[model samples]
Target: MRRKKGLSIFQKLFIAFLGVGLITLTISGVVRYRAKKGFIERTIKSQLTDSRERSINYFNRTFTIPIKKDLGFIEQSSSLNNFLTSQRDEALLTKPPAERLFLHFTKMPESIYLSSRFIDSKGREKIITVGKKRVRDYATIDHFPNNVLYRRIYSLFERLKEENVGSILFEGPFRYKNNKHTFVIGISKMEPEIGGFGGAIIFLCDLTGYLNYLSDIKFNQIPIAFVFRPDNHVMLSPEKEASPGPDLYQSQEENINDALFVSSSIKLGSNNNVLLNLALIIPRKIFSSELKNALIDSVLIGVCLIIFVGFVAFFISMRLFAKPIEELSRGTGRIGRGDLDYRIKIETHDEIAQLADEFNRMTESLQKTTVSRDMLIQEVNERKRTEEALKESEEKYRTQFEEALDAIFIADAEKGIIVDCNHAASELVGRAKSELVGKHQQILHPPEEIEGEFSRTYKQHLKEKEGQALEAHIITKNGEIRDVSIKANIFEFKGKKFLQGVFRDFTEQKRSEEEKKKLEAQLQRAQKMEVVGTLAGGVAHDLNNILAGLVSYP
Candidate 1:
């Protein structure tokens, strides 16, 4: 297998930062998505619940009126009932009995109340009204008796008795001709004027129009309103599929296929015992729209966040990792090309910075220790020129030093040992330069002056820096004592302290001064003798002249 390529520092940094950004964004997105989804669900449930409550309240308002309430209008009219039973042919509702039934039935609404007919104990019509204009007594109903329409009514009544009945019975939904539906509402009554005959007032209702009206009720036209049986048959609906489905009738509230079905009982008649359910069908998209919108927004926001963090990571990788490493690489290249002075300028406070510092130090060592042949030669020549200059300067000063009349000695200030002496100092000490050097400064002086005059002068030179000479005596190499005046001072050279003293020899001069004093004393004595002899000669000459005269007289 070939060698696998490894990721570079920049690649590693890019991957690390980008991966971290993605992970963090993923976590945040998940949390935000969950929160948004939950909020949307809650809002949908709240809206659906509110809509269900409002629908119940609305249906309650519309169906509150009972259809069975005739206010005892037909039941209390005994004369009208007896006349309706006695009449065979009712003429245009002109008979008092027919006119009373017509006017009474007219009070019922035409939409739900199609017609009202009163039956005697034999179940025959005494008075009947269809709509506002048509009226028929018991004779007229026998001719038109129970058409496909009335047969459907009687058939519906059969279905009504099976239900839980109250003071009034509400039933229906018998399929009429032209695909219409019919319902019947009735109550048993006793007419005392007609031999206490047991009878009933049955109303034929146009249920299709009323059911359509109820179905048409909607909230902003979104949900469909309808009535359904326990068997899932749609009694009335805006869509009118006839059979909605088997699942809808499971409960008062249900969710099927992502849609919500909320139902409330539509109670009718005086007893309000008719159990019809008004179902409000809410589709899937209406309530799910909140969750859908939240999903879209969360995806968009998550994408944006990931992109922004990735961009930031790109720059961070470059600044923190790539740039420094590139500089170090360039520095290495420079060093390879013999530019040892080149250094990486890395500003990062990390291991990369430490590497740069170590690189610079290695480069510095190379600069000091490693060089090309021509560079070595140039350095050597430069050093030779410096050495020649120093030697020439030392020779110029040494000539003046050696030709000096006074003897000079240099000693270590800390060691009190003589380090160097000029030629004159060697001669004054009566010893060679090698013998005098490396010895103590006190060794040049007499034994008595080692701790006395010489010691004071040496310590005073260190204390006062520079001062006048002190008279001192030294023993020469030949065993002669020499008198000298020593002047010493402290000075620093090459990071060390040194003491230098100049010795002036005055023994021969002192002897010449003593010989001149002895010569002057002898000359003074001879001159005094000459002066006395001259004065005696002058007195003798006078006395001889006088003695010659006195001897002649004596």
Candidate 2:
């Protein structure tokens, strides 16, 4: 026969430690990567949501609030109305409302107004003024009576007469005369004297400043602002020209860049009448780099950790196990190779050294043991008989413990902790023997008795050598209560005293006694009824005899 070689314990242990280390490293790496990646994604989404809210407030404040303020001032100004209606002669006042409006229009530089004008109900220009530039070089024109655009302009003026006071009308980022991105807003003017619709005060708004500010609104150094109509018409964008780009409502990849987009619907002014979509766009690449770096670092650290663990396992196994086991094997080989006086020796004071000492002692005692082998066998036989008798006694005790009708419990005398219980005890408690053992004596009593009656009785039982049969009730695992007569006796085992208890369930006997008392009471009542009936019969007989005597005398 040949020996089959297998992996040594040292080799198996090293591989096991290495495998566990690698698996742990991989799991931790994956968890860390996911946590960092999720954090980055949440941060991006949060920024986009915040941008949407800010855009709503921005449109309302920058564009809506200003137009509202202008209309409010105009509504309160009587001087402007008097000048437009031409109610009085110029001799009435030197400073006229026409001159006041022109001065206010010139000061509209900061407001970015290209031109401000007043038109009558009949499509006639009442007053007009330009800002920053002389002459009419602006994209929008007030006087275009005979041109192709005249009918369109006149139609707008007629519509202005139908619109109510404080209503605002707007037109384009359209290119007409100049290649300028401009818009015209018309506020309906009212005739307060008749309270009728009168005319319109229109302003040509230059949006170049707004577009530049829109360009400057950057996220992570990328221009994010976009202006578009509800119909997806591009108004102003970071593009060099108005070009149809990717849909900003959904996320997608493009040759230009992949981006995060958020859209918010807002009116250009205070009136909810006209809606526009304002969006912010940020490049996805800006956030990707940091997340990638975090994952790479984790993988690298995990690989290094696996390598370190493998080296530590190898070092420990060689130093602690390999050398001691090899020396023990060699020393045992010398004893087996026919040297009776040889003794195994190992310097290390570990289990391997103890094994060597055991081998040496066996070799030294071998001759003496062989000479007395028959005597040793006879002694062993006697010891076996003693053990068999002890086992038979234990068998008898176990039989009585299990077969008894009364539940029996063995508990430590001092602590009252139940150490052993019979099958009958389990049946009485409606539980398993395993469940009853290791429980306190108080467990057999009701909850109300604990810490009061049970505590006092347990203390009293500790002092007594034997207990008198006491009437009690025990609650079962099924929440049923049964009357029992219980008694305990203290017995000594190895100088420590323990309590052995016996319990007899007598709930049915108590019920029978109560029934007997009730039956005696019923018998007494029946006897009293019989005596009463006899007395009544005798009284009737006496009355009959007296009546007979009276009748005979007559």
Candidate 3:
């Protein structure tokens, strides 16, 4: 018979180090890639959501609230009410409402409203505009011969008289001159003190102009802003279309050039009325570019680290393990080649050094056992000496097994019965040797639990020479449950298949790991909230300035 050749210690150590380095590199790469992907996804979604929220806030602050305040001012205007109460007069429309009241339409830039007009309860009309634009004759107009505008105006007037409405922001009519849309922000009580059917004031502003002003204000990265009616008609879109879809009332999501699209719906009235579908198109690529670059850099760094660690590991393994193991190998080779006097010399204190000492002792013992064969040629004496040596080896094996620090248990593989256990096992389970020796292995585990795990682990140990370790809950004699990690293997003992296992307590380590994960999650949420707070502060500052201007401009 010939012995098979095996890998040298140097080769084995190099392979082990290389495998570890490659596996580490692979796992790190995967984790980094996934984390980067998740971060980018989160950042993109967050930016889109933030952009939508800011858009709504800005729209309400810049356009909606100011419009409401302007209408409120018109409702409280005593001079305008006096002007309308007396009769429709061109001279009264030309002047300011009062010394304290400034006409909003006259103060606004000519580009803002295009034209601001007033219509009374008697169906009389007068223009109170800033510029000398030709006033279209509303009486001679044939666009609404069926009186659709008149009916809508009357309905709003009724709502105002009944106090059902204070002010209204509504889409009124289309101007025939340029066929442009108009938004009428009207107030019912032009003269509230008079207390008798006081007429309303309608401000005709070009919808396109207001939406253009809104879209011009870029919140971040030049967002595209547009509005769509419930009928899917484009009311105002200074930029390109935000999304290509049939439904225009609801919010939308789209992707363009790796950019995310988000939309919000801001209705102008209370009763499912005019829906201004505001869509803001922002580039997510711009937001995630830094994270993408960071991920690439991380991958490169991981590769470099893997290479550097492999080289360092190889150098250390050569010095700590390979050299001593190589010397032991050479001594064994010499002994096999008839040089039994050769002894391995190692100066380290690790496992490899211990192996060298054990090998040397083995050679010395072999020499002592066979050296006297030439001096005394008695078969019975040699047989007796061999038996004595075998008994001594068995005693040493028993002592090592019984005195091991970790709890060890031997059970019958087929029946799951505890056949043998050491002192450590008895102390760990809090049971006497006599009480546990003949009992089933289930006595050491939680009742109604861990049964499936016990069966699976036992079957796995029976099939594998090198088994795996797993966490399990064990029950002690006092019914206290303990978390433990068990490593089990199968072996044949006295013609019976026995499962032997070592138990290690691992409750504290698992708890620490869970706590660490929870802390990381909390840190992420805190960072997100901090960003939201900063955005809110900036928006609030702008809102304060806007309100100051509205109040101080008059």
lDDT by residue for model 2 (111-135), tens: 6666666666666665666764333
TM-score of each: 0.41, 0.44, 0.42
Model 3 CA deviation exceeding 4 Å by range: 1-21, 28-30, 84-104, 130-165, 172-181, 190-197, 213-226, 235-243, 252-259, 269-275, 281-298, 309-554
Clashes of 3: 0
lDDT digits (tens) for residues 395-438 of candidate 3: 99789988998889999888888988888888888999899988
Off by over 4 Å in 1: 1-64, 71-73, 76-98, 101-111, 137-148, 152-166, 193-197, 214-223, 229-231, 237-243, 269-275, 286-290, 298-554
**Which regions of candidate 2 fall more than 4 Å away from where they truly are?**
1-24, 28-33, 88-95, 105-108, 132-156, 176-178, 239-257, 301-554
Return the clash pairs for model 2, or none: none
Candidate 2 structure, TM-score to reference: 0.44
Give the per-residue lDDT of model 1 (tens digit) for 1-554.
99887987777877887787678666866677678766765555566566657655654543334453462455556555555445456433435654556456555564456677655555456566776655654532234456665664454344433333224565554655577666666755555544343555667655565565555555447436677653456776666553456556446765566565666665666556644566666666764676667777877877787788777877777678877888889888888888886888988889989999998998887776745666889999999999999999999999988888899999998888899888999888779998977888887876776653346568777876476788778888887898888898888999999988998999998778888888899899999999999999999999999999999994
Which ten-residue region of model 2 has the weakest summed lDDT? 132-141
Error of 3 at 57 (Å): 2.9
